[model samples]
Target: MSERKQRADATRNREAVLAAADALFARSESPRSVSMDEIAAAAGVGKGTLFRRFGDRTGLIQALYEARVQPLREAVESGPAPLGPSTPPLERVPALLDAMLRFKMDNRHLSMALEEAGSGSPYAAGHYTRWHSDLEEMLRQIPATATTAGFTAHALLAATRADLVEHLLGEQQMTPEQVRQGLAGHIARVLGDHGND
Candidate 1:
């Protein structure tokens, strides 16, 4: 096959795998219960192909997580308003954090699986660095937070960690809206604002 055809086939196969994995994870009561074998079968690809495409389950989960959140990332990167760069640091900080929390809430099972995979530290993941760096920059723009921006960014992100999200939504039975409101309040307190903004 030509290089172009080869590339096209690879892309198709990759999408198929991701779609299958997404469906399986979404339907399973437990994301971790969805195995590589099952994903391969559902995607109509060989086990070797899955391994070659994603390295391992950890890599697959990571890719899926990234794929799932790409839309949000793009919005924050270049979209408009609350999430876009044009927004003020004071307003944008909480909005950015809220977006992250909402994503965790919406993709709880997948997020949990991704967090529990690999080194068990989502902080070490590639996407985490991008988010942390962006938030750190945003925090730095505020006079009050500029000094402790790095630490503050990490701390705020910790509030949306997968395990905590799971606990808040699962064990604590907090609705997604309630959790978002609580996070907003906490972020406001951290920012020395009343969070009503």
Candidate 2:
């Protein structure tokens, strides 16, 4: 095959694998139980192809998670108010947290898988670093949080962690709206009333 054809085939295979993995994770009772072999079979690709393209299970999960969050990343990077760069810090901080919480809630399985992957430390992930950096910068813009922006960012993000969300939704039996309200209230306290703005 020509180089262009080879590249096209590779891209298609990658998309198929990601899509299959996504479906498996979505339906799985536990994301960790969804094996690479299953994904390969579902994608109609060889196991060797999966290993070659993604390196390992963690890598495959990371790619799928990144692909899933790409739209949110774009919105936060350059979209409209609340999530975009132009939003005020006070408004933006809570907005960002809420968005993240919703995302974790929506993609609980995949989010949990990614968080639990590789060294079992979400902090070790590139996505975690990016979120922390963005949140820290936003917190720094506000006078109340400027001094402890880093810690504050981490604290805020902890509320949106996948495990915590799972616990709240599954164990605590809190409704999604209840969780959102709780987070809004917590953020309000943390940011002194303007957090809900």
Candidate 3:
């Protein structure tokens, strides 16, 4: 096949793998049990193809997460009010955090699976840096927090980490609304009255 054709085929295969994995994860009560073998079979590709295309289970999970969060990332990057660049820093910070929390809650199983895959510290992930930087910049805009923005941003993001989210919903048996309200209360305390702005 020509190089262009080969590239097109590869893209199609990649999409098929991602789609199959997404479906499997979505359907499974235990996402971690949805193995590479099952994903390969569902995608109509060999197990070898899966390894070759994605390196390993962690890589595949990371890719899926990145793909899933792309929309949220775009919204935060430039989409509109609340999350967009136009919002005031205090309001934007809480909004961004609430959005992240909601994504984790909505994708609880998948998020837990990704975390269990031992992909290493989430701080090392590229997406984490983007979130941290955006949050840190916002925190810096508040004169009272200028000096601690970096630490504060990381701390805030840490609250929404997948494991913690899972623990709250799974172990603590907190309803999603309770979790949201709790986070809002925590954020309000952290940001003072400015958070509701």
Query: Candidate 3, residue 34: CA error in Å?
Result: 3.4
Q: In model 3, state the lDDT of residue 154.
A: 85
Q: Write the per-residue lDDT of candidate 3 for residues 1-197, one digit (tens) a residue.
A: 89999999889989999999988988887787898999999999999989999999889988888888899999998889899999998789889999999999988767777767764776776667888998999999988778788998987888898889888998999999999899988887877743334
Residue-level lDDT for 88 in candidate 2: 97
Model 2 Cα displacement at 97 (Å)?
A: 0.6
TM-score of 2: 0.94
TM-score of 3: 0.87
Residue pairs in collision within model 3: none
Top candidate (TM-score): 2
Q: Estimate each model's TM-score.
A: 0.91, 0.94, 0.87
How close is each model in CA RMSD to the real structure? 2.6, 2.4, 2.8
The digit string of per-residue lDDT tens for model 2 on 49-146 reads 99999999999999988988998999899999989999999899889999999999889989999888887667867999999999999999997788
| Alpha-carbon RMSD, candidate 3 | 2.8
Alpha-carbon shift of residue 93 in model 1 (angstroms)? 0.4
* Candidate 1 residue-wise lDDT, 51-155, digit = tens: 999999989998999898999999899989899999999989999999999998888878888777876566777888999999999999998888889999999
What are the runs in model 2 whose C-alpha is more than 4 Å off? 193-197
Q: How accurate is candidate 3 locally (lDDT)?
A: 0.87
